[model samples]
Target: MVDDNKFKALVNKYVELSDQIAEVGAELVALRKKKDAMGELVMQVMQQGDIQVLELTEQGGKLIRRESKRTEALKKEHILDELMLLTGNDATRAQASLEKIHNKRTLVVKDALSRKR
Candidate 1:
């Protein structure tokens, strides 16, 4: 009868160890899945950041081009006004026309700059 009790106790101990091992295996699998998901999220965020940087660079280039064009237009307007005054056929009319053109160009340039900001 004592031998029987000892044998049963040994079997119970073996069963308990098996259960603990199974629980640890399940926990390891869960940890692996969470790690994989986190890796994927990091990759997605990096891709989005790259896209945003590219867009910002393109916008900067466009703004530079627009500013250059505006400068050229303003210079041309100034030169034409000076020439018109020197020629002296109808100074008042020429000045008025030049003023109108300059005003329109200035508004367009201001609008573009504002949009960029």
Candidate 2:
């Protein structure tokens, strides 16, 4: 039956979406932990009685940048996961739905970052 086939397809997509959500959730948690650790380390360095000028080494700068980028990537992945879960009921519509979600998430992050200054 065509209806049965459609139902099966929907179920499969739902399962895949669930798995993606779990993966993204784990990634988000790890990203948060990493960001927190970096923040703590920076705080500890600042709290030291004698702040060494060498603390701001090139390597440290690179590490900070890399961590920032990782956080952004995790956020993007989370948005994608959410999009997939929401659109999983209809395979034909999923791609457009995901693109919209991606654009929205990008704008949201951009706006939030801009407000920090």
Against the reference, the lDDT scores of all candidates come to 0.63, 0.64
Off by over 4 Å in 2: 47-117
CA shift of 54, model 1, Å: 22
> Would you estimate the TM-scores of all the predictions?
0.31, 0.36
Query: What's the alpha carbon RMSD for model 2?
Result: 19.2
Instruction: Report residue 38 deviation for candidate 2 (angstroms).
Output: 1.3
